[model samples]
Target: MQIEMKNIHKRFGANNVLTGVDFELLPGEVHALMGENGAGKSTLMNILTGLHQHDEGVIKINGEERSFSSPKQAEEGGIAFIHQELNIWPDMTVLENLFIGRERRNAFGLLKTKEMKELAREQFEKLSVLIPLEKEAGLCSVGQQQMIEIAKALMTNAEVIIMDEPTAALTEREISTLFEVIRSLSKQGVSIVYISHRMEEIFTICDRITVMRDGKTVDTKRIKETNFNEVVRKMVGRELEDRFPARNPSPGETVLEVRDFTRKGAFENISFSVKEGEIVGISGLMGAGRTEVMRAIFGLDSIDRGELYIHDQKTVIHTPNEAVRKGIGFITEDRKDEGLILDFSIRENIALPSVKSFAPKGLIDEKNEQQFVDMLIKRLTIKTESAETSAKNLSGGNQQKVVLAKWIGIGPKVLILDEPTRGVDVGAKREIYSLMNELTDRGMAIIMVSSELPEVLGMSDRILVFHEGKISGELTKEEATQEKIMTFAAGGQ
Candidate 1:
């Protein structure tokens, strides 16, 4: 089962997104597709998966030329893709989600419930995925939900599996389990098209690599023949000196304090504080309640016990609106789900938080609005056509900037950023790190929840390790190290 794209050419009016892109995947081999954001990775996958039509190209699968009019057709032809944005339904159970499109039914038209659940459970067990099949999919941890999505892909017995950024939210242990599954898939002769932003995963698993840049194929070579720096350069057209910027200023007096905060099962007994001009980095295993603590402080989740104080003054924030009014801002991890409205323009998305402040008696000040958003766009180096371009048109990194700009426009005293650079490119991540330094210099106390351990150590003045719904350890800048945090976190759990 070999898949080949011969001289693919796709365009939209004046924008030639993909130009003569060519690649091939051999059976039983894991191949990684590496590229920066808006570099035609998603577009090419869409064409291969039948979501988009190629203007000009020929696809050959198993030595036969074929065309896919729809995703169903592609599935019938033995192609399946797990997109970067998850395609699972939150309301459905694990078994239901797996057998959704291909539900088995009897002659009398009754669905085979027991058979499906048994099959689903077998697949999960084979993949070393632990998930409660009867529970609602939304209630599961993000790592567990990702495994369920993988099980759905396997339901098709797909010969060629395309996974995009599969481990973005997974912890070290979960990723190890997923790699085991990938090895099993390869042993079963399943060809894998793995797309990842993390360089570490590619080096660990991929047998070969295809690098894309500016909508064209740059190079394809054996994994051992190239290095990480070389791969990154091929993807972005330049060398990246640093991934995380330096945080210099020492933490001042405590600006925001949470004393013995408890939020039931979501998170509990979290006591921490962020000082002025300091970044307090939170690290943990997946579902270890790092984000929950941040959410509780921002009033997204209510606390049942303990006290929150701002600058030594006790304050109770009941809602997000109150948190905002009290000069606090939160950047959610799921940007598309919670941070920005995709259909709206960049200006509207950026102005959403502060529109009331600038609006005089229910009348929006367009001039003032334009002036404010335009400055942010320029300052953040947001790439867009005016401020009126739809947020959907921007790249992933730019969309993240829109979310940051939304909160930054309000000039909040305490800024909390969750997975701030999840899908951003290398250059964008550096820019974001620089922006964090600027904000801290202006006396903002920042609490950042991040999955990338290097980022936590690189940007934080102090580090807090969350194991399982509790604080496991706290370290100042000098004492925080990868070995220390990992040992504490794994044991604390």
Candidate 2:
């Protein structure tokens, strides 16, 4: 299979998202599409998938010019898109979710359940996924659900598979399994268009790389010929001195303490403490209970056995509202579903956490809210047309900044961030790390849950390793190495 897009041009009202962009993919190759946020990567992909029409462009597959009117047309033509956001039917079983809208039926309209199950099992085996076929998709963890999305793409018999940040929600082991699956598929003559902000993954798995800037193609290079620094330079059009900002630790009294927290089968006896002016990182594999523990601390989950102390005072937090009132903020891992409302405007979303302040007398002070949002937009460097722009209209990085702005407005004493930088670009990741430093400098305690070992090591003053719903070990800034953390994360004694 050979796919070529030439001189692609697309515009949304006054925004020219893609202008004179060119892209190509060959058979049996993993082509990486690299760019900073809002560099028109998603816009170009949307044009190819028929979700949006390009003002001017040409698409050719296998030497035949093609114009798809809908996503179904593109799918039927052997193109499948695995979106960055999980798009599975949560209530349906894995098998049913995979075969939705494309189920095989007999002449009498009876579904071929057994045949579909067998096919699903085969794909799962190929991907090394161990999830139960009959299990509800929502019951699975984020990493497991990512595997299901991949399997669903494979079920389409797609020759050209487009994976948009497929590993964003996966752990190290699940990522390895996905890379193996990609290699196997490539060897079978399946061309893959991989889009990711993670530079290491691109270097490890992709054969060729295309860098886009603004609304145009910057350069394309063979992975072996180009290095990470050069690729990043092209993507952001500048030199990045360091991925993580310099950390200055000035510890204060403990602000939040969890003693022997337990959540039945999810996690047990998880104990930790976060001090003022400290950035504590939680490191672990997927399903290792990092997120579960944080949820319990943030009052999103019930704690069966434990004690929570805030400012040296025992406190009872039975709900998120209570947590918020007790000076706690939680930025969930799945930002699309939990962090922000998609249909809401940027100003509205930013004001959500502190709505009471804007409406003290039962009526919203529109002027005050707009001024606050404008300040956040400028301070966070959020790129948007105006405060009224929909959260769904902004780039992934900008949307993350909005989530941060909302929390910052609340002035929480303890902030819990789950996968804080997932799916964001390199520039934005640096900005977020800097923001963490600033927050901690102001005596705000932060507990970060990250699967990226480098991030944990770079930004954390202390690290807590989790394995199989337990605290395996703890390390200080000077003591925590990637190998040491991994050893503990793998359930080492």
Best by TM-score: 2
Estimate, for each residue in 1-493, the C-alpha lDDT of model 2 and write its tens digit: 8989999999899988998999999999999998988899988888888889899989988989987888899999888999888888899998888999999899999999999989998988888889898999999888888889899999899999999999988888889989998999999999999999998899999999999999899998899999988988898889998888999889899999999999888899888899999999999898889998888887888988999999999998888999999999999998888999999999999999899999989999999998988998888889888898999999887888899999988999999999899988998899899989999999999999998889999999999999999999999999999999999999996
Worst 10 residues of 2 by lDDT: 294-303
Worst 10 residues of 1 by lDDT: 242-251
Provide the overall lDDT of each model, using Cα atoms, as 2-decimal numbers. 0.87, 0.91
In candidate 1, which residue pairs get closer than 3 Å at backbone N, Cα or C atoms, i.e. clash? Answer: none
The sequence of per-residue lDDT tens digits that candidate 1 reaches over residues 234-345 is: 8878888777776678668888999999878777778888888999999888888888888888888888898999989999998899999989999998887789999999
Measured over all alpha carbons after superposition, the RMSD of each candidate to the real structure, in angstroms, is: 1.7, 1.0
